[model samples]
Target: MSEPESVKDLVVVDLGVGMPSAIVAKFLREMGATVWRVAPPAGDPFESIYPAYTSWHSGSRMATPDHLDELLARADVCLIGGEDHPGLEWSFEGAALIAANPRLVVLQIAGYARGFEQRAAVDLLVQARVGLAFEIFSDRPVNFACPLPTYGAAIQGLLGVGAALVERERSGRGQLVETSLQQGAGMFLSCLWMSIEDTQSVNMRNPPKDVWAPIVRCADGQYVFFVPRYNGMDKVFAAFGIDKSIGDTAKKGYFGDIDLFQRYATKFTHEELLRACWAADVAAEKVLGPGECWDDEQVRVNGTIVTEVDGRRRVGTPLTMRAVQPNSGAPRTSLPSAPEDAAPLAGVRILDFGAMVAGAYGSKLLADLGADVIKVEPLAGDIMRTASYPNFVVSNQGKRSLHLDAKAPESMDVVRRLCATANAASHNFRVGSAGRIKLDPASLRGYRPDIVAVQCFSYGASGPRAMNAGLDPLMQAYCGQAVRAGGRDNAPLWYRNLYIDYATGAIGAIAMLFGIREQLCHGNAVEAETSLLEAGLFLMSELIQCADGSFSGGPPLDYDRTGFHCTECLYQTKDGWVAIAARSDDMAARLVNVLHLQGFPENSRSWGDSERQKIAERIRSRTTHELLQQLEAADVWCEKCNENGWQSLLDDPTARAANLIVETRDPNVGALITVGPLVSFSRSRLDANRPMSVPTGGVDTREILGELGYSSTEIDNLAARKVVA
Candidate 1:
């Protein structure tokens, strides 16, 4: 089968009900694919939930559902909102979609993949069930302001679709791809989760507070944040004539005298501190309010935020692609697709120079897809390899590792040799670091013009903050998620956790897919990249603006630790807490009937103190499960907030059976249970038993060297010279 000419040659049908399906459809359209939105007569019932949806769906091709079957039969890809559409809640729906077009890639977006598939899967409930309530919000239970699970799930679902499409070029067949809001939450915490025998990992709220960056107020009472891992912060202080001691505090992750640092920081306004930090090469950003980031200069220049023709704001697509038409007689991108029993990416090879989680996790996913990934580590390995072995293991599992001192002149030879056999290369090294070592995309293109290359940056590769260190916390502070998540208190708090890091890694994986698709379908090699800031903005895409600078987000969460009102908020039961998501009027009426209340007042997003107290009292009267059963029976979305024990989620019987979570045995760790790839392929099989390969780092240096035809003496001499390990 010949490959389609390009994304422009393909037809994508979006039958999804909400943003999760829309996000993927938008991606395909941006990539030049013909996209059509097929919806119910009511269009999208919950489209009003996001104010930005007005702009997000601007000019979208809305096709009548009367021809939905014909559209699916002729489409190259189909996106179904498995979570929002009641019709897609069962396997029969997915099976029917795939059976409609055996050559179509059917991507079903849902709230949960397994055990709770039949439940109402609201993003807030998914986050609550996944234990994000205590970690993202304050220590006490608070409704996380962002719809994070759906945002992340949208990207994960896109990844699943891209990978399946790439594999289709080889197999000439389609597969069912599934992802959920629950899995989206899992993406944020995938690498951090660990399981061995009966023990499971827990959340890391106090993870490393200093690593959160100092959230300091400016002279005008506005807030700013600095990169925690950056070492040049003291230089910024000295440039501003502040005490270098306070700067040293920042360099040490604000270890000592935080108040002193805050005092010094307050001496400068956002412009003043930002200018000084730029001059000193210290990465910093102002803590923006919801929708304020739509005007950021850095994001503006990098096109992270763009303006539609009508001047409405929109987040840029995750992929920034550069297409290069192949030279005459160049080979095609399609390789022999793995057989029916093999993983989708069985024949692909990737050379990964990703250092930390931002760098490592995406390739970790590609590796999970059955690609052959070779980790090109510095002599000491990744900077964070020792920070947490479990993290490193999760991020670099199943890959061979080679240690090289890129600074050594001899190392270039080894790198070039590996490039000859590699289809792609990835890295998250500091800005200009790759160029200094001649490993940048342009340099590698000279070695393999058809290679798929991707780079991950803290900021983007251009614009004002491009040189910033890879700081996920600072991104949260900068993009306004921290402030939004902070809710009524509005301290702009951020956790030292996976906000943009893991998602950026996932985005990087998508960038890789973009390159690979270009090579396969377009007969071109592509260069694609994204940043922590850009990824964060994508996560916060709903916080947008209109032509007149009017904010698009709904009111900020004012009544902290709860939902918009009494009917929608979480309830403390006699046992523990259960979250209630009765945002719709119907659900709210059902909830009122169940609780025996006259219902909330007509004109308030927040409950008065006394009203809240009365609601809490009524909720606490029943056990959590009893209330949950009553609520579920009434068709109200409710979920119990879980702790880290939810980490062994892959061990759930339905999940394991679906291959959404697979059981693997590692020689070093006996039985290891890990999340199967977030996406599942119905026609293809994964090497589930070997999901994890090493107990520690890969010891494949000699083996890899031998494969490259390096002789024993030469390998020994290189090792002796400290050039290779």
Candidate 2:
């Protein structure tokens, strides 16, 4: 392996128009790269009003005599985002051209793959390209209004680019990489996965006393969350203001059973009961709405929520990297800014062949960070364009869209041309027949050297189910999540939202970053891979029987529900509900005190034995609000489970101090809410925002083609052929 002289920044040469391209471009700029917008031949031009600048190379369109040669000659890396339109053969031609490139990189945007179908396609592409490429899959199957999932994938691509670049420094070569959507989805289903194995053990043995509590409706039309650990149970019993002995056992009388707790819960308003519980230091919380999450003290002060808008705040990045001493003599530059026009990856070029949530959202995240992502759409455009999304603007903030038929020779030619000038290209094909859209990474190298390609799908690109059609719901059922959610019952319920898909995207971003770091270490590119099944296994690791470890009798029954720890659950309250987890003895004792119970029951029953029913019957009567207040005041470990509201979040000043929201104006959408760049660099400062304006599909085609040296007449002729869609 030979290290490159230095890390050369990426230069973007956008070929299409849409939020995807804009997003990719935004990422480049944030990374302190340069951007050179390229106008395609058929776009509707309004040059004077646009803010970006472009180079004119009219004569060098895709497959033009020396187009590939010139692009590779001038650029260190090429990037691509989104996919080309259908009906156009350009995507296919582009695939071959890119496989031929020696220096270009590709980023695939397929969100989630069912089974292992996507993985197989990626493997084939890897074999064909014989160069560097990788896949990004959404954690789960998703159908949302906005492109929230795209953030996950875009961040992953940016990280991948960095890693691939580092690898190029080591091996002086590149390889193909891919991720599985099913795996991505599996990553986010951690809770459910753990429940499965727990339940399995419990099914084998039954106990008369159950400790877990369910979410119950309150009289105030609100919900409350509560949990009964040792102390909390005692507190609830004490709150009932009784020392009644259930008989049997030690010094006195006591009983442990869900029925006992139920009897007590029914006596008081949820709130009144909660106060008694809170005095005891129970783990509990009220559910919060999206906005309320921002206001959460933990969220606000923990620096986990980054605000990108005045009114919109979201979860922040949870990881960071420690910088190593430089091995080379080159001095480090200051942290890059995040401004739309002057940020890193500004001039970096990318070719996007992704669709739906996973691939598309991945590119979008990059755009937010200042990368020029060119979304090459099929004739019909990305399916998301017509998706029944509730938040369409979330993912499409900064990107450009271009429509081209990947199957058409001319369209493929266009894709080839774009790849020739891209720093990387990407694709996200699901595991089955849906993966037909993937391009060979090695083949792309034929058109340009050292190119990076990112690919994501359903299953692993190399597994048994590599070609199966997998989606979120299917993944849930297959992974044993549905079963866990249903508890003793076999009937499973699908989660209302596509959490797995989004989580996969997020994890993929982290992988991409790691891969890019490796590339920087070697003068070669590295392939990064992940799978849905692997993700599922990871999620359920706690529940799965390890090859080397013994089950040895799970948790104590007083706190366990089969495999489920019934103690960590939601509890009804007076005003609402709270989610709580009482795990320690101290916590349990505090709860008892808060409930105002004094002398211990005469019964010799241990903390979590089956002889504590008298305590259960007492706490059931209080209201959720009162319980939350009491618990919170006592510093109990708990929180509210928000079904969907934001009042509390918006009112939290701590959230504002944590930089959970930042204000920025968009060129295209005007003033709107945006989420995070959710990361904080202790050593390097980061500054970037979405662009003010984004282009629509084919909006700048003619102008871009003109720069490529295409004669006006030729440009018009191509439009007549409907080659540019």
Candidate 3:
């Protein structure tokens, strides 16, 4: 456990709960920062419930809020959580703290932003407000068994803080950083929000016809999940003794006659089916529930799960960077003056060969960090330009675009030449596609032996479905996420947001950063691999567990006609809907007092069916404003379920203060307002407020070629030959 040289002397103050703040503390600690965690007098609320809490705050020294001022005076960074907790008013306190400590870096995590900053929200509430619930359950809103919103936000928070730290290295100042569950939800479903086409408009929305659905019951009553590549479908059909002739047509029709295939699938046991599928080169895996993941061979081999010294099982960080060490030290608050024109990653150069949201977003992240990114595309442009312009804009910002037909010998030479000069290169092509274009790690390494290479695939590099084409929806269906979220009685549903894709993008960015760090430290290049499937598994890590008899699934679904639970979900009020959380004993007691429910028990579970019904009725009897006032005054967590559009966020003072939304004019889209950068810096600021406009295909082709030292005559000849655009 050697510490990273860059963060060797950093000190961080961890405030609030374990969720986002603790998660941030964990990452910094891993990077070699000494973390001092400030817990409330009653102790951290999640300490007893979430095992990850202990894992994240492992080496941090714990203290009460009384030491907050002293800690801040010596801290390089401070992570604050508990936006909804009544004991802390972060908005005002944060402002005061920053005023007092001009160089302090404060990162705050909240449920929502703007005018609703004071409102209480958890993962479940954020998911419902952002359309995840409606997408998962057609009848009503249901939270995933896990806390995806918070986890996703936590990842972004880490990235935001890291970027700010990079900026601080140059500017010698610290700034405030903020992120929220709502923002995380947007990133999770970046594709859905940006795409012009809605999922419901397609015939594939029906679960029966969803070609991506992978769960199939075998003869032995066991279940297996598999994803077949375009060409592998024929082998799958043949293994089941079905005519391969129908494979192409079935695929075109989104798995035509699903029932017939299911009937045929029943002939083999789960193990037999998996064996046959693997023999035929189809990627498959057993449908391991949350309780069964611990013993999984692949999971263990990948170090995705680890048993702590205390014997508690915990999830491990997916990305690995061996060159960097993990140790403990206090960071230096001041350093030598930096260059006036310094950018966070001014000296780094990256070659971008990705399309669609995942690869493009990863490159965009690098570009935002001040890396010189050159985007390589085909003559037809990235396919996503036509599929979703908004997505293209968001993912292609701050990069120079070039078009090259890799099939041509001249284009292949140009790509190799580019790789020689680049510090790193990234692509999201299906498994074998990179090799065809001579952009694979081996080929790129031939040009620059120490160059970093990053590859993103749908499934993974070694899985049976490694070469298969996949998207967010498909991965969700295959990983049992759709089934778990949809519940046992309902049809598996796909979340409209391409959360897995964006999450993969975030992970990809981290991997690239690690690669850069490795080169800086060890003077060696590294190749990193990540996939949508792997990211999905990581997101569900906290929930996956083995049931050892003591495991009892939390309270049964308290589904009402409106699709929310009475005790801990959204309820209709006189004016509008309000989301409330009164599941805990203290909160339940407060709710009982506020609503004047005479006979309702303070113990949440003691309430009978009739009592629950009475509470719902009483809640509906009052207006949203009245209920919010009563609940909030009584220290209960609640918020109005905002159904407004993104435009409304612009008017929020807190959002504006934090620079959460930026407005920029674009040549193609006219005036544009997009989500701003997640973090802020005092002396140096990354302007995410600018429109991330998409450049026309080959818009900078000649310019980039000129930089590559290609002669004018050669460039013209290549353009004439249709090799360069």
Candidate 4:
């Protein structure tokens, strides 16, 4: 398939700084949009330092701020980075821009949701606030070596832009769309924040005990990670010359005892164990550094990592849609316009067969866009409903629920009927499970030839471990993420949050959108697939590249002891803590003046060890408030560390003004305050006043069946037969 013409006429003005903004532009460019990137007269600070900029900013035109008015005159969308960043003052004039061009979609990115919008924040500080820092290193807060928060925020920003464009198609007017690092982090880690009936039953502070842990050291002193399935454990044990029955007993007795398992695992070399596991058909892999992933055969063959014509290597977006065929001469169908006051996906219908985080979150994203989502549940309902109430509520909000038994023949007919009415359907069942339930693409297509089907799994559909059951932690370990972030000495720690699951959901949503675009361009359905493994790769892409055919993992020379680059790190102040990022020369100079570092050079590398220590000491002598005031006056990037947790945002002026938080009463959980929608359109913003409620499974089954042309008598018979709940 060729690139769709839908975005060909769209002109995007990218005035944001850094990789996040560049990422949004890259997605637009991929969809054939014309992006004109407006930088300062002096150019981006990272232009000469970061190779990611080179990769993300490719295929775009560059302009200076002087052309802002001219660019806005023709732009359909404008992406603005944080307000305090150098050369981004123009982005603050959203009201003026909309007055001039009422149809312009202005997307602003910020560090915090509201009150702290003007404060300087980098990826490190954002990660710290969201618990990533503390999660990665148990002893103290340490930022990931890569900028994951930035990427997360960027993906949300991209979704905002896409939704706004869809809204514009109907309203013919553009609006302001805003997303922040804090908000994105919350969404990315939704599963972790979930509340259950008995919180004590599941401990977020420690690793899960049921699944076998993946980390093991080899005789060669290298770490290897693998998820050994229970059924395959016998084979793995046999290959290692251990009695299967004895090994099973040991596993059952010492399930959560890491020390005991390690003692047993060390009996064999890492290479030997990995070979045995692979031979036994268990899901296993040697832990690889970011750079080493570039050479992995699976990554290379799947085009997960690509080498550009300019010789720069970068990770590719996991979401893929076939291009429109050239010279086919098929007439393109224009998407129908939404009605006034309609949501972006007002007319779209989605079938939610998702369970847990990956599947349900994808459907929730669509539901937020105003799609009519019918959540199909089993007779007993979604397992998460009982396991985690918060997870069930957040994932199924704004959708109607129906219950059916997939094993019943009559229920399969109901699923087919529903498929005939849905524009798309998504599920995260293991490979072949969808076929067993008659909801796979082949079966769904039999009902609706043009239905878009998205299937997500632990691994992808074609991998050797395609059918293996996996979770976020297991995938993280297997994909080298845990080892990379935890450093060499520590046992590979699972990310504190469900980063993989949320990322997979976001990617799945993108895939569904692309599939919809394909159907609009060509009258055919598309099957979209993504995996937790792919999400992990995309998150760690910034560090996954090779230049000299060699691979190693270590902190850069500029790394600070506080978990950020020297120019951007957390520091102690007299009264409290502050996070600073004096990335540019100008900002560095301002930082020097504010901190009274008399003899220190702007380049941190130029300072002697003693001099650097002295500078830190001097800064530590001042109060956090005083330093923040001084830094703001000097235009240096900095913010006081927010250790008060997410509740602090409740009183934030910017967050309130931007509608970043909302209060609603839930039938089961009572009054609650939750993060609001990531994007806000001038006309089609979600109704913050609407109570978010998830009805019990089968609550609407009878109504749904009635709508499907089944009479009361037929519905009764189906229910009596255990076909429909």
- lDDT by residue for model 2 (598-688), tens: 5643322234322233233334466656776787687554444342212232333532332223334543334433343332211122244
Candidate with the greatest lDDT versus the true structure:
1
lDDT of 3 by residue, 1-725 (tens): 13234454678888767466666676567556689987766655566445456676777888777887898998878887743443433433566667888777777777875345434657666765655444443333445454566766777777666656655555666777667777666565443333222323222122221233555778998766665454536766766668766545454544444565678879999889888877877666665444355454544544556555655565555554333221223121222344654445665788999998888888787776667789999899897776556667668866888999988988877987897678789999887888887898778877776667888877677644566566676566555565555444544444545677777888777667656655554455567777886776666544423233232232223434232245666677877766677646778788888999786666665665677677778888999889989998997777666554343455656655654555555555555555555544444545454335556678889998988889999899999999999
Q: Ranking by TM-score, best first? A: 1, 4, 3, 2
Model 1 TM-score, all chains together: 0.89
**lDDT score, candidate 4, position 565:** 48
Tell me which residue pairs clash in candidate 1.
Answer: none
| Cα-based lDDT for every prediction | 0.72, 0.39, 0.65, 0.67
Clashes of each: 0, 330, 12, 7
lDDT for each residue of candidate 1 in 537-648, tens digit (9 for 90 to 100): 8887676677887877744565465765565577788988888876666666677678887757653334466666776888999998899899888987888877553454
Tell me each candidate's RMSD, in Å, in order.
Answer: 4.1, 24.9, 6.0, 4.7
TM-score of each: 0.89, 0.49, 0.78, 0.84
Residue 268 miss distance in model 3 (angstroms): 5.4
Candidates sorted by lDDT, descending order? 1, 4, 3, 2
The alpha-carbon lDDT assigned to residue 592 of candidate 1 equals 68
